[model samples]
Target: MHCYFHLVHTHERILDETGIEVSDLEAAHYQALKAIQELKQEGEVDDVDWHGWQLEVVDEAGRVLLSIPLDAAQH
Candidate 1:
């Protein structure tokens, strides 16, 4: 089985305070993960986050296939 890792951080206090729908978050997370996997297979530099979420896709061998830093535009 393949697994994907995500690190999410929000500087906006409102976001932290707001209640997030678990099902929606889960669906979006997996969808983004799947897109990253496809990008990895396509030989594209997978470093993109649609929202405020960082993603890291690693293979079973513990090799990082993709690493995208979210909130990059903020810098």
Candidate 2:
């Protein structure tokens, strides 16, 4: 299945879009977290105040199904 993972941040109105192919919801969830981890590792999530950020998992129709809450990527 194809899903869109939206990284929504506290101080930003624009969403960071990541498209992925997954088998099911479980896989989608994993992919979302993995993306977040990669972004953090690359220092991509540092410049924002992301204390209340979220990994929003949306279906093909753009319906949000699950949201993985996030903390600040760096201290």
Candidate 3:
């Protein structure tokens, strides 16, 4: 069985509004969500962001397939 991992960065708005600091693991999940959205839109692979957070795509074997840096340009 092949397991896919999606990593995502937490949105600044969400962090500020909630007044919660996301842990490293949670942040990855957030980035994954963003990556999935990008994949859906572009029908391919892409990375976004580069500040304090970023997104990473991985496989079941725990290998990073892609890394996307979250940047302001995306917004």
Candidate 4:
């Protein structure tokens, strides 16, 4: 299955144009966590601000599978 990971806030959304293929929802969840970790690392390197944002994983049909706060990636 292919899943899209989008970064969304109250007023804006950064869409993932190229979705990833995963075996199942569980794998997709793992990917989301991994993405968060990568984002954290990149933020550390570049001093990016990711406050008030969320990582939203969705299916091709646009059904949200998981939602994680960007702040949760801290520490």
Stretches of model 4 off by over 4 angstroms after superposition: 44-46
TM-score of each: 0.32, 0.75, 0.35, 0.87
Give Cα distance to truth, residue 39, candidate 4, Å.
1.2
Residue pairs of candidate 1 with colliding backbone atoms: none
lDDT of 3 at 22: 37
Error of 4 at 5 (Å): 0.4
- Candidate 2 wrongly placed segments (more than 4 Å): 9-13, 16-18, 72-75
Tens-place lDDT per residue, model 2, 1-75, is 888888676665445465778999999888887888887887777765577878888888889877876674344
Worst 10 residues of 2 by lDDT: 9-18
Q: How many backbone clashes does candidate 4 have?
A: 0
lDDT of 1 at 6: 44
Candidate 3 wrongly placed segments (more than 4 Å): 1-50, 72-75
Top candidate (TM-score): 4
- Comparing candidate 2 with candidate 3, which one achieves the higher lDDT? 2
TM-score of structure candidate 3: 0.35
Q: Give the TM-score of candidate 4.
A: 0.87
